[model samples]
Target: MTNNGNKYLAGAVSFAVFAGVVGPAAAVSWTPPGVTMGVPLGAAFAPGIYVSNLTHYGDGPDKSITADVPAFTWSTGWKVFGASYSAVVIPEVLKVQNKVTSKDFAGIFSPLLIPVSLSWNLGQGFFVSVGEGIYFPFDSDVSFTTSGQTSGWAAETRVAFSYLKDGWIVSANTIYGVTTADDIGRRQPNYFNVDWTVARTFGKWQVGAVGYGAWDLEETVTNAAVGKGHIVGVGGMVGYDFGGSKLLLELTRAVEQGGATNYSRNDTHVWARLTFPIWKPAEPGEEHTALK
Candidate 1:
């Protein structure tokens, strides 16, 4: 890779903070699956402004969604409890289709704001990080918007850990989310999900296997507590460093659909991500992670 530092930033933010997929039924968690592939979890970052552009296409029975997401991260020199602190914000444009209804809906989805992101290095290439974020709805009503807009506002917590040393990148990130009742008198089920990655760096290329799963934690309007619905997908990722930026491509196929109830679980997802630094200080901030 042209720059090991910049190459890994793609890994650190692969989890896209708070992108969710919704279907006719409360298929699963609000957060989409496989959003964390291609990158390591909680990679230590150098103080700077970094940006990522992602285009995601998802398909399922009777429904599909295409999303354009732009995210900005700031690794500030600020410290929180001995850990380097960072913040991220994301906005999205969505195109959703209902194959059965033969109708397409397009609009902006709720934006995600992560105000508290803290990463701590435990040495030996191991790191732990935590973040708190909110998926706040826009003031205007999007009643015509597809489920891609989700039911209402959501609050989520992110916890991540990564092993980045030598030429190996292994990591896991988890999100636990709960939503408030929407204006329509419905609330998404409380949910838990995880994204995991295992990759090896070879020169300028990184290849790995990635997967994610989501399960409901409580009953919702459409589901019973005994047989709650879930979603799971497994895929592969390939990434490369281009000196000026990093590029990652990922493909994931769903392995489980919530039986005949949640059709959105049976689908395919693809992602193309590009990450680059916008500004860097003359005296670069130290990479909080120490690689021996």
Candidate 2:
């Protein structure tokens, strides 16, 4: 793993310099692009529609960009409801350039993810959530791997806490991976991540800062074979909430790469997302309705 880290660092530097003019989209956010993957546990599920794009670079075999949509569902009381479907698609150019020749690659390989998670309010602004998910490689190319790509299963778990004070809010979340594509000969190791966000609102405008970190518990790849890797990222965002609709724009940078320097070796990534209410709101005269 040590050797792989050194090699990855060298490759990462060369790649960064070669691609010197780091594009605007690359600095969008330090976290995963979707609201589902970033959602805090125990939050009420409000039916809505969301669209997002996630692009990753630096790692030789791990470079990819995926665009996705999240379809939300809610149960009565909203206390114990779950999300059923979520998916993503990758454009063609990225597939060809990265030598991601195979559709059956591992580690951020799939274009879609189906997650089923439940959130519960523990009272007093704190909450707990737990869920499971599957990664489906619907349009992958098996022969794309020059060294052979890996495609298989991935399992995830999430836990979090959130608080609202005055007009400001804060949330902390942690995600853990138990099993993945390792069965298919890929070294996808276990990992844990923490995400924190501080937000406030004024009029119809919402603003906030997001900070997060990740640690690899096991080294499934050579670069991560030794001690776990660490990564710290921070970004700022502003959004508009129009009673029933919301749109947000964000910019983030990776300030530190602890061990996965080869994997997420870049200094920054740019991102943005737009979300809309797919469901009609209750009549203005109606009170805030709670769905179970």
On TM-score, the candidate that comes out on top is 1
Q: Across residues 169-237, which tens digit of lDDT does each residue of candidate 2 receive? A: 577777665533322343334566677777787877878887666666753224233445556667787
On lDDT, the candidate that comes out on top is 1
For model 1, the stretches where C-alpha displacement exceeds 4 angstroms are 1-25, 139-151, 221-226, 259-265, 288-292
TM-score of each prediction: 0.83, 0.63
lDDT of 1 by residue, 190-289 (tens): 7788888888889888889988877777743332223465767889988888875888898888787562124355688888988888986888766742
lDDT (Cα atoms) of all candidates against the true structure: 0.65, 0.41
RMSD of 2: 8.5
Worst 10 residues of 1 by lDDT: 1-10
lDDT of model 2, residue 166: 61
Global fold similarity of model 2 (TM-score) = 0.63
Residue 6 deviation, candidate 1, in Å?
46
RMSD of 1: 9.4
Span of 10 residues, lowest total lDDT, candidate 2: 17-26
